[model samples]
Every structure is written in structure tokens, then in C-alpha cells.
Target: MSLPETMQLSLGPVLFYWTRERYADFYREAADWPVEIVYLGESVCSRRRDMKLDDWLGLGRELTQSGKQVVLSSQTLIESEADLRDLRRLCDNGEFRIEANDQSALQRLSAARLPFVAGAALNLYNPATIAVMARAGMQRWHAPVEMSRNDLARLLADCRSEGLDQPCEVFAHGHLPLAWSSRCFTARHHRKPKDRCQFVCRQHPEGLALRSQESKEVFTLNGIQTLSGACQDLRHEVSDMAGMGVGVARLSPRAEGMAGVVAAFDAARRGELSAPDPLALVEAEICDGYWHARPGMDNSRATTAP
Candidate 1:
């Protein structure tokens, strides 16, 4: 019942705006989890100042001491010079590896000759771009969320032919980060502007859920990040991913029941259990169409079946 020897579990950065204590506590608990890699830092919005860079670094140090490979993640969108400065500090920290969520971070890390992880937000679609990233010192790559299994297989086959050996990771669990916007949707929901919005995002803990006029869950808004209403569950596809030469499976951190989630994936990878039904862990609908090259929201159970 052994899984692929190369398959490792990774904990992605916390996408939610959590209290500093809760955030620290989460990592403290994660320090002993079965996961091998831990990605830290605030990657969504620059306004989430509840946890600063030093706090993340301090936590990263603790995780590293606990024997986990920690990687500092950069913001997905860089809107201000201050954000740029913060990104620079993360890159120059010269301790843990960096997960470049934005191209600016990629350029900074490449220029410094530091090996980095090209995050899913980078939109690395083809082997050509992947090769370019490899040349730029991307030691690992997280395939974009929308990429299908067949597409990734073809790309990886091409990369193999070209002798590109950079390892790749996939977002295997949690809510899919669909898109980013400059406008603060959270503030707008609270009748506030982007500049003076009094940090209303914290009130939702897991981001505010948005529903259609018919009361169908559509999207979730967290500051400027728009996420899928249904959390993505690719545990069923772990074997497929392993067959494609994926080296790591990223489990994005959630607010509650993360321990059980991690255990489920761990056991699944160890071939002790099947992937738990994603709907059991989430209140919203579940989707896996993107993995099948269909509509992003269409899982076999959805009403919009083909």
C-alpha cells in the first residue's frame, strides 16, 4: 500500500486573515504534523497586517527547528512601493527558501541567485515557461489551479524530453484561489472604501461567502482575493498526480479541522485509506472539473453534469 516514494505533503500559507495568536498557534500545531514542507507568510493582501514579516520568520524558524522545510511566500499582487519593499525583505532574508507568488518576487529571487518555488499564481502554462523558470532558478513549481491532468502530463513529458528536472507541486486541498482584484470586495461589502476600510475582513475568519440572487453559493471574497465557493478536493487524484511525477502535494491551511484533513491526506498517500469525500469537510458544494479539463465548477456530483 505504499504511495510514490517521491510524494511529499506540503502545508501552504494561510490564506485567511487570522489573529496573530491563532496564526502562531496554527503553525505551532503544524510543527508536529506529517507534512514535510511548510509555506509561510501573507500572500493575498498587503492590508492584512495582523501578522508581520518578523512574526512569520520567527514562526518559520520554529518550524525549521522542528525539521520541516519552510518556504516564505510573497504576496500575489504588488500594488504599492511598500509592498515591493516588503517583498524585497522577504527575498533578502537569506534563510528559508522563497515561494514567488508574483513575478516581481521571481525576478528578485532570480537576480540574487536564490532558488525559489514558483507559486500557482505565476500561470506557468507550457514547458517553455517552465524551462525559463528553471533557468531562473525555480527549484520547484506549483502548477496553476486551473491546469488539467492531461495538460500537466503533456507538459511534464515535454519537460522530461528537454531534460528539465525541476520538481512540481499541486494544490491538492482547500478553497481554490480563483482570482485577485485591486478593489477591496470585503470593504465594499461593509460599505467602506479600499483605502479607509477598517479591516472588516477579519470579521469573516474564512472570508465572506457570496451567493447568487437565487441563494446559490457562487464565490467567497477575502479582501481582494476571489475564491471558489466550493473547496477543491483532489485527494481522489493523488495517484494520478504521482503518476505524473509530482513531487509534492500542497494542502492549503483552513481554520478548523485541519488535523483531520492532514491525517486523511497522509493516510491516502500511504495507501491506508481512500480520499475522504471533500463535501464532508466543507459546507459548500465540491468541484474537480478543472482537473478534468471541464468547467471549473463542475464536479461529477454537481447539477450541471454533461
Candidate 2:
């Protein structure tokens, strides 16, 4: 499909733990929000048992009733037969689109002829891969947390030239999901392995905060994934994003206070909002340098995100 100029808002899948009731209630309330798309599923360690496939599908159906486009997310870094099976099932489900997080999921999705969402976990950098995927039935392509505006502009231009029609979504907010591993770090840190993780990642909600040698709080450990300590804040970059032709800005879920964030982005997109520090208190530290190919931890005052 051709990309539109209208600003789109989406809530990326929750990467933390909340009770099943809380999870359901969150989506229930999201029906009243201005979000256009909602991605649901357990993308992290399968050990996260707050909800199951049937429960997720039920919520997806309810969210669809609310007039929101729902996509089921596949696990990144699939290791076992079970993971592959689940990915195939999600990709095969004609009821909703699949968000393929890894190449394995991408392969299955491609073979299934499903127009899917290319999850950020896939390092889809250039136009050729994007075109290939679009031809293979990719409907939307999500920019990895660290992609920059200039690079994105080139990619979009390339898409237009290649006649590849796909919406480009960016990680406009939330903690930068930096890396994922085959072994569970949060569980390992607590003296455990993948098979015996005992699902410790869930207990931490927002993942376990990891500090530096200087005792600086630098990163967070969730299951086998490592993330930036500071949540990515694109509140100030809404104009830049729109100007650069971003179709949608994905706001990752937080522990609380997300509606205000949604409202801020919407108002900004529509020229109804103003702020000096839009995401003032949300980020542990601001870092847009990664998006600029600079130091991943460096914060820029000229165009910092926070």
C-alpha cells in the first residue's frame, strides 16, 4: 500500500510484566486512545506467562472491535522448535497481520504470503532488502531504534523509486531495545540459565537495571536482551519525523503515564501542542547520538531526545 501523509500512532508491544488483568485492561483503555495500530504478544522470553496465545488473540479481537489495527508479534532470536512453530502460527493466522522480529520469522512470513510488519529486531538497512521484503508481502517496515533521519530519507526515496509501497514506522519513544541474546541475562545475573530462568525477567517489570563500572546506571537487562537505561524520547522530534516522511511513530509501553505521551505526540502532529522539555522526566538520559551514528550513549543538546 502507498504511504500516507497523515500522522499515525502505534503502541508497540509491552516488553515488561503486568498481571493478565492489567494487560487486558491496558488494551481495553487503549480503545479510547488515538493510537492507530497496536502490536500484541510476548516478544521477549517465552517464560513470560502473564498471557498466552489464546488470551492474546482474544485481546486482539477486542482491540480490532475498537477500530484499531492489531498485529501479533513473533519472538526474536528463536532457539527451539516451539518458537518456530509459534512464529508459523502467527504468520499463518489470516485474522491479523504478523510482526516478524527475526529473519527466521521473516522467512516463514515470506513463504506464507502474509503482508507483515518487519519488526525492529531485523537489521533491514538498505533499499534492496526493503524492496525484496515488500515484494515478498511486507506491508510495513519499522526502523530500528538507532536509524537516523538522513538514512531514512534515502530509504524512503529508494522505496519510491523501486515502486515498493510500505509504511515506515520509527521507534519514536520508549527504552531503546539494544540487543537480544540466546541466554537469559536477567535470569543469569540471578544465577540461572535459559531452561531454568524461573521467569525472573517478569518480576522486574521494566527489566533489571544494569550500571557501569563507575556505578553509573547505564543499561537494563530483560530476559536475554540488553537495553538503554534511558527510554528513547522522540517527543521533540515529531516535526522532524513528519517532515522526513515518517508514516507512524511507535510509542513503546511504559509502566505508567503513557496517555499523556500519546496526547503530546498527537497534539504536536496536529500543531496543537508546545513544550520546552516534552519528555522531560521520562528518559534516564537522552541519547539521539546512536540515531546519528555517534556514540550510542552521547546526548545532543542541538537535537537531543528526552
Q: Which run of 10 residues does model 1 get worst, by summed lDDT?
A: 274-283
Cα displacement (angstroms), candidate 1, residue 133, comes to: 0.9
Worst 10 residues of 2 by lDDT: 275-284
For each candidate, C-alpha RMSD in Å?
A: 2.0, 3.0
The C-alpha stretches of model 1 lying farther than 4 A from their native spots are 275-279, 301-306
**Per-residue lDDT for 86-189 in model 2, tens only?**
77777777788889998988898788677789988887898888878888888988987788877888888788788876888999877789898887888778
Steric clash pairs (candidate 2):
none
Q: Which of the numbered candidates is closest to the native, going by highest TM-score?
A: 1
- lDDT by candidate, in order shown: 0.88, 0.80
**Predicted candidate 1 versus true structure: per-residue lDDT over 137-231, tens digit per residue:** 99999998999989989988898999999988998888889999999999999999999989889888778989999886688898999998777
Q: Pairs clashing in candidate 1?
A: none
How many clashes would you count in candidate 2?
0
Residue 112, candidate 1: how far off, in angstroms? 0.9
User: On a 0 to 1 TM-score scale, where does candidate 2 land against the true structure?
Assistant: 0.92
